[model samples]
Target: MSLPFKTLIKIERGNHLPMYVQIANELIKLIRGGKLTPGAFLPGTREMADLLAIHRKTIINAYEDLSVQGWIESLPRKGYRVVSDLPVIKPRSFQPKNNYPATSISPEELLHLPAFTRPGMVNDYQPGALIVDDGFPDINLTPYDFFLQQYRQQLNSGILYTLNFQKEEGGLLSLRTATSSFLNQTRGLNITHEQVAITRGAQMAIYLAAALLIKPGDRIIVSEPSYFMANQIFQQLGAVIHRVPVDEEGMDTNALEELLKTGTFKLIYVIPHHHHPTTVTMSTARRIQLLTLIKEYQLWAIEDDYDYDFHYRNSPILPLASADHDGRILYIGSYTKLLGPSFRIGYLVAGVQIIEQAIRYRRLMDIRGDFMMESALAALIDNGELSRHINRSKKIYAARLDKTTELLTSSNIPVSFHKPQGGMALWLRFDPQYPLANLLTNASANNLHLYGTAYFEGYNTNYNSLRFGFASLQEQQMEQAVSILAASLKKK
Candidate 1:
């Protein structure tokens, strides 16, 4: 039976997509929506062309595409029919609905009360305004031309269909393998491709890991000044968060051990290398102690090493996952920091079983990742471009860090900060006389933007500090920014 192909398939002549490809995609959607059942015969090329008022060659091309994708089969005498072997999917209306009403049910009405509050909208700065972001990479340093070349190559490769429709929720095998090798060589992690699941970013990796391990009423330990977003994720999952102090040695393992003795906790979230907000690397002794505690208490640990590549000082201490023998650590890292926040690519490394579970959980939200970008990144890693970029970035960022530190110290702003061993940002604390809120207001008036410190404040501790991101600013811009900050501080 010939369905109403004219009514079902609305071709957009103005769309940038080719008419043939659009028709093929529409047909596939109809088939999946059950309008065209298995073994249902389709109109011949001429008939379909006449029915749709398109060229016969266009109809033939669409049909051929469908056949190549296994959505349809051509019979000797019967023309084309939907493939009988296609899996039966739940049917939904294929027609586009116009002016659908907003959802009437509020989240609080449908689910548990006290639903997670939405975070404030991001501040939109003027185009030329200088922004002191919270540790973002300098996008100008990205090897985008090389990345684009690899992206084009992947798109034109013989495996284009496979790259477009890969079924692995964990991600492209090539990227995962390359990531496995890169981590092994650079971070000393003993992991295989099977132990890695690519995520949108480290944030998603953290969410997936938390989803896999956390349940309501479960206690999770975090440093006093922890990553707020991670804490919010745990809270949204109904997990109670406990705080341990973070001294110069990192999350005081002694304090955590003492807390562990007091109560049972499901997981510990630590940023051992370049700890967020404070930019303090956990001491080697503390890392060992934390790992030992994890082993002794049979607790899970999430080591978020987001900015491990830009360490300015001596060789970066190997991540906790590098020494994880029993699969206790779920290590997360991101290419966003290496490239920029705009590039959303990260991975979670754990045991094979843990990664398998993470992949399954990830599928509930994201079916698959960007295979083309992942493939391009794989090419970059395979060729030494990524490492070379990191090497160059370290020197550039190290110099900027020095310049910013020198300016801030020499200025009469009355601020104190430790020279970080590694990472992109410097943690600066102004004297109590200069309230961060007031400083932020004054900075804004001077056309300078700075991130707020309220998120880093804890129940009992108020850190009057902000993470001064120096990587994104050059020497002159840093000078201008510091001058603006000094002017802001001088305000009555």
Candidate 2:
């Protein structure tokens, strides 16, 4: 099945690009055009050179380029063949007829392809600026030395490299085991490592669950002022979002019940422990009622307890999954709040079937999470270092939370907020006279960085509020930040 190479690949010697690149580009066109099918072996470099009347080295260079780009693979004594797993692509009739361009294509031209374009929230805090971040852990508080030591041990033991090549579907087995034990002890979840799938973060876990459960036009319920990023993911997947109001008691389960009666819903996204943007924990009564409704409606629930590790006032409530006997709840959690966001480790706890399917779906986007880091985290959990660090950080953040609350109360800035029992960040509402837009502009001028209230806005409602994160700020920094807020308020 040899093709006419000389006629198919038109060599333009007058073109400025290298001859090898020209040949490589022509072959790529053939492969993409379905002329050269997967597993089809290429002619020997010498044979190809003889056929094309070119230098053998040029053919070698072209093959090398193709191999590096993963278009073709080399087999021992078998020569080069196209990779078997590549998706079949139809030729673009819009492209110039058999005329390949010599110059590199611009990314701007590539952007014309049909794809979702959602920009992520960027953390662009400048150095020397006072910041009220969005409830992120202070990186300075992370036990990096201990974690690095464990990471180095994993590197030296050679387990990381072994696990990298091996297909450990969910994640490293050691980390999953450690995580299972840790959750059972701390959150009362009765599960094994087989029920867990490690993800890059809670965001990825949410995306994976949505991908598995939702279909186009399927109805899903979310809190009115829920995590916006999760809402974007559901919408992107073509799910219709129904918002239920969230008060101090948490997602008004009564309102949710009413909505459930009107239509069929596939899933519900709830943040029971310190609900994002509001910093309110769902009452025990509401949790019970919500769980009962979930069973009644046969709805799948994504219970995101992302910051369950840092409770200050009392012991945190056990996750909804702890009581789920029917495997209706998919629990999502993250280590980003405990170990700084840079760590990027999280997990989804569910039935073995869901875990297995989520792992398969995860492969489509990310092959696997960082094994070395997961192993190191497992060691940290086993050695009690992570628990100790969390205990120590809780006390410091509690004090910071108190100090910030007291200072803001005394400052007379026309602001009101309830001191949260747990989690990082305070939800503060400003007087309507003081627009959040103006306050943000004024704060920016004073070198004080604060997230705008736009993110927390609900459908057809504007709540002039912001989540004032205090965990990342020290006492003196909190004082300075409060002072800046007062000044911003006074600026007309």
Candidate 3:
């Protein structure tokens, strides 16, 4: 039974396979080659670990694998012995030893793609860095444990039979129903589950709406200095985008009306509440005017209500989708921030016919969404747990927003910003005297992860502004960040 260590095995450290798996694989080869015959006793876990200079757990895992595969059996007091019987598994075709291309592309050819990349792609995560972001919620405040509990209870219950199959292309009926109820109460949209399609997130909902409403060469009106990602999406679809200047009132509905008179547009995309990147809510007058214009032109509108729940000041304005009686608006909202961005749960609200068409397009792109999580969200909504979480987090975020605003104002850095009525971020415009490069370099030197001004610099306009997100920062962090920003501004 004595075997030299070199003769018994050779371990390759550079291999991606875990040491335990490699050990099991080498042992399997020995067993198959009859070097270690059936009923031959093997070394104990401790003996193997010592010989290989690895943790005993590795050897134990290897033994467990061998036992599960019918390769070996453990005796009462003795070590593992090779099994007498084995299952027949046909050998797979031989794979070439040559290095394959990293991508699934031909060696001689190059694949060209549109130069489209995600907006605000983080190049690196610097530890202990304070980030001024484009309005994201504090996911750390999410009720993750409660949601996990519901998921676990459902998984352990008898309803597993129902959830195992594909439910509906529109998504879980329970979630759709729950979303309908929530929207009816909060956003003033009276809808049924049939009028909604659940998507991975609001981005997917935007994609679906665009795919359904827009054709190549179709004109779509959007706000200048609007969401970069939304413009990118429209560009990818070969749609011509017309930008209307946005001021304190939000997307010049007057300009939009003028554009409508001049030419036909397929659809209009608007962020009515806490308008993306700018953090400006559409004035009540503009809302009514925009609604009237859309109705008259029969132009479909995509209203992105991504951060509707985080209103801190006066009550939120009723969504345009709520007042659209002529089927002119498609409302898109996301629970991704409430549950964390990784939980890609969003809903699109439109006429039942439009929803049906969107479902078709959704099926072509993604076969279905996460049913189990959707169902869990439904349970949260039904019991009012989701509402309660929102109510609680809303207050905490409001305080954080106040603290961030206070810090920025006290910094005296010559930065001007409108005191936002609601939402998790402030739209800060620097004085033209301060160079953005100087500000960015100083911010980076102060350990603040400041993204460049690409987000504010849209196709038609370049505003010296940035969305200074507040929800994710604590009071101390906010103070530290503002102090650093002030210091950056003071330098030259």
Candidate 4:
């Protein structure tokens, strides 16, 4: 009998890392470094778990990730085998000239900055999840065939290859120009090309904006309950976080002004149109008030309009940038929500002064930015495929949203939610406060992985809530998911 793989795996608890990823990465390194040769059969998950003295589920998650990523093939009864048939990993460019310095920064300093980490909810990021992930598009509706054809055309143009290696502020010209046009037509903003700085995604756009605008101990205002990720970014930038309460209309501008008078904050970040985590769109009057406050206080407002594309309800809302005549507001938009995240493109609309600073910071982070994907996306948008994709996607999400709402509401499940207009998700609150987070965490055993409102804030709110992204689940699947979730919630 072959020795169990657990005997081969060793973990140091002092490392403070998740056991699943630790084991997974070790296997990946063994394969990539060519130690684990092809066709090797690995130990069964339960056998390895027994040997490691860890949960069997942990081993399963590791195996699942490897399977989804095409690193291994699982055969019934025989166990898992290495997939040496997988192609060699070759990232876009930059032949390794030297090693990256792995230096340690203060934990305090590290805590306040945005992490490039993503939701590890899925085994592999499926195209379908793009609707739920702010970076994903409706994979079912995307015109891949047309895009592949256009990609080849752009590649043959010869301009794309040169553009791919440098972190040109605002991405490539062909791409930037196309994005600017889309912004103009959709949001009604009068912007010249020079003011737009393309970064990786909205997260990077927000990070660059916060890093440039906020200083250590500077005060900045955010919605009382807003995007957890954005809050993480602002806190990482060392901004003194002040949460201005938000209502149906949007951020409490009056409270914002009062906070400004105390001489506490230098910047205010608002989701405005379709405020994150809540799915409430701000009113036009509030937008005007915020712009006025920004100029009067001489403070900058960072607008994260992450999902302006698929307005499922009325006409798409205008971005705060559209109304910024004084440039006091920094507008951040992401193609990640509309385009594929592997594309890694987002833009910042701000005064030329801030744009210049952001460019310097971006270059410091990564010498070369994404070019091939940016170029391809630009061509897709230039040809109007992006708009079509968004429209089709919105319709599909809207239908799914309606169905999800109905299923959860009408089901025997003990949960309630508010219907959002055009976004991909619904915010839900469970009854009598079941341990939603823990339950969701444990529910992985049932093959249902969903998001729970655990990390939404620094402190515990003591409520059982969840944010469900309907974009990925089919209309039919939403009912079943809710049914399973309802049963999961009921379990003591």
Candidate 5:
């Protein structure tokens, strides 16, 4: 009897399982169900491939797997056939009862956790709409395929077993060592793998740094319009947040110095390069003065240089940690903005004592990062692949920023913005008379996505400004988006 190929075999492409594995498993089920009896011949690979609308290679691989498992045999001058003696396996007799156990914890009994408010940019996303992100990189420039190739090579070479199973909860030695060398060479920072704790991203680094440094009711200083996520982390740790004002030259060190003179603060958080939402680089004089204060007062600071690689106008100032001889700064950075957000590789550099404390806390939450990915990244860094990619991405992002500025200038919208010297976004301040909510709704209807005005909501006064990230948007898309924005303003 001939088998009905279409009715007997079905492959679900939407499933996480591979098509070939699904086919092989389905054939085993058919044999067990007595539909394919002992000594029955199977259909040809080509016929099955055509019937299923899949490639013949998939059928071949499935058949090979079945043959290896003794479910089928190949006869001379003939195709595959079901084996005479199918492996006898006892059927399961017990069924799991669906009743709830008395000891099981109910949802209502679970302890209440700390509450963190979701920001607008994190929640504002529409499918199939062109988005003006908040300082995100163009993911199209990421070399993921190359990284995948490196991963496969290491897996095949069987060298990842030892590389992954090391005792250090910090990170892979090779990656940390490579990162140390890279940071030292590029940013004028000196550090070793022992002083570096690899993290999933800058956010994780911030959380770890905050958790280790902050205690309940301890005062910590932050910029007024600081990175909101970092501020949230500090608040979650029960730290009293003292906000200072920022100017065109970056965080006002004068204000910080005055505060330190009369009062004591546990920690201060600063983003010196292309400050978030404002895109202002800190001046050299402020940096020197800030370092002097940190040393004199023995103050600890978290220096987050999230986008250190995309500078366009001139050479970026070295991080505060590079000049701190007294070890007062904990430097944090990530490759998410440089490579892609999906590549969650960030690092923290500090003194050995703090790194040891970070590692102890890190082990409780995460034993280690993805070693295979980290190893592959180290290989890329060693061979200069990451360097080349950064150089290429810098030029592309610079051009995109220039083009976006031109479009925004010509849009005739009631918005004023200064071209950012570095970083991926433009900070646009709308007239106080313009309605932000209406503008966002109208722009969404026009297929243009803009972040809601929730970023600067916690401030004393409502600052009518938004960071219009342009690195991810193409020239044509930028033009269309700005045009829609202008139309939305007119509609309002």
Candidate 6:
């Protein structure tokens, strides 16, 4: 289909940026400069290419690239058009558009798109929907009104107004001290505030830690079939990630030791306390071995303690940091699973020197994340509200995990998993014959959202596993969710 593009763009073929990218950038500049208004139609690729004496494919490539990266849109028979939701980067000084209030953008353009493995199923499950999915708390247990009251009190307080752009290391007075005290009591690690760098969440903390340590051509050791997102992050940073296979006792220290002797690794990321997708905790002896290997190989051990707060059985073991003789471990934790996602608070505790370096890198990536929430978190900690809330949340999570595991075991589903002492996820390994592609498709048909096992180093192995977050599901719904999941795989 042919359409008209009225805008003009000057592309420099010799620029360091690629030809297509240069074209995209010029369009971006026009949009930002307000020369290209929203809803304006653009020229067809072949026509524009003919006018500019470039290949039709080049123009098409530029348009496709921009659309993919969330700049423009293509409508059938209407050529490319400037995104209606685009925000103009108005001139700051004396320009009327500078005072132009911020306009809205759609969820399609923004990065915060929900976790939709399938393109069209995100809105399939919703609050108050009649379905067996993990969305809200069990209405029978906690009072909705009580939580509202506490939240309202926080809003009325002075915490919201004083979101100072404090030290890049994180909030100093309230939250920092609380994090130190909480870790000391819960994890048995005696880290000072200076050693702790609070973050928007554990994911960001991991990114900062990885960025601080990793660069192009550096080697990093990871568990085979490990957390796909973490692997993706490390991969994006250009580090060569070496995947070491795991067993029932968390990360394979012996395999790592052998790998270390043969190759140099800049970082080794592990979920030692209760691993993701595998649900295995590293034995203390293995922990010692890992620490020894860290010193022997001179590599940084990044321990992602994502769900240590919820241990159903005996007390949760102190994380690797509790046993670190040297300052090589950067223990990470977050409150997303426990209280709620809105907290957006996570912390990394390391030696004072490492914290300093991480903060410098953090500032560059994003300056002072969620200052108001951070300050409120500090207040919550100082007043012991945070501790109390976590303790209560832990019991609730423990019950959910127990019920879910019991149900899965009773069903005799062709799945077996080591019950993690702590953590919210249940890592289920299907029979060797089960293929992930089929399971995902069938599961979605039954209105279930299941992720693959690759995130926990399950890529190379034929093991079919999935991590289920029990902390978020209603206790009654876990049985149904599991049954649907099990049936989906069986049918496939």
Candidate 1 positional error at 279, Å: 0.6
> Per-residue alpha-carbon lDDT of model 6 for 113-205, expressed as tens digits?
124253213445644332332222233433234445545665887545544535545545567777888777667776668778888788888
Write down the worst ten-residue block by lDDT for model 5.
101-110
In TM-score terms, candidate 3 sits at 0.73
Off by over 4 Å in 4: 1-136, 154-161, 164-169, 452-460
The parts of candidate 3 lying over 4 Å away from their true place are 1-123, 451-460, 490-492
User: What value does the lDDT take at residue 248 in candidate 2?
Assistant: 90
Q: Given candidate 6, what's the lDDT at residue 346?
A: 85
- Summed backbone clashes in each candidate are 0, 0, 0, 6, 0, 13
Cα lDDT of model 3 by residue, 90-142, tens digit: 21112211111111111111112256433334567678878876666777877
Q: Per-residue alpha-carbon lDDT of model 2 for 11-111, expressed as tens digits?
A: 88986447886787788778877888999999999999998999999999999877755578899899999988542212111111111112111111001
Report every candidate's CA lDDT.
0.79, 0.79, 0.75, 0.67, 0.77, 0.66
TM-score, candidate 1, is 0.74
Candidate 1 per-residue lDDT over residues 1-492, each given as its tens digit: 557789999899996447997798788779867899898999989899999998999999989867755678899988999988652212121122111111111111011224333122235766678888888889999989887877676667766776666798998899999999988777777667988899999998988888888878989999888887888788888889999888777889888889999878989999988998688989888888887898899898888995887776676777777774367778899999999988899999877777877888788778999887888888778755676577667768888988988898898788888999878888888777777777777788778888633443448665768888999988999999999999888433
lDDT of 1 at 9: 96
Please tell me which model should have the higher lDDT, number 4 or number 5: 5
lDDT of 4 by residue, 154-256 (tens): 6778766666555565567777778778776677666656667888888888888777777788888888787777888877677788888777788888888
Regions more than 4 Å wrong, model 6: 1-121, 126-169, 451-459, 490-492
TM-score of each: 0.74, 0.74, 0.73, 0.71, 0.74, 0.69
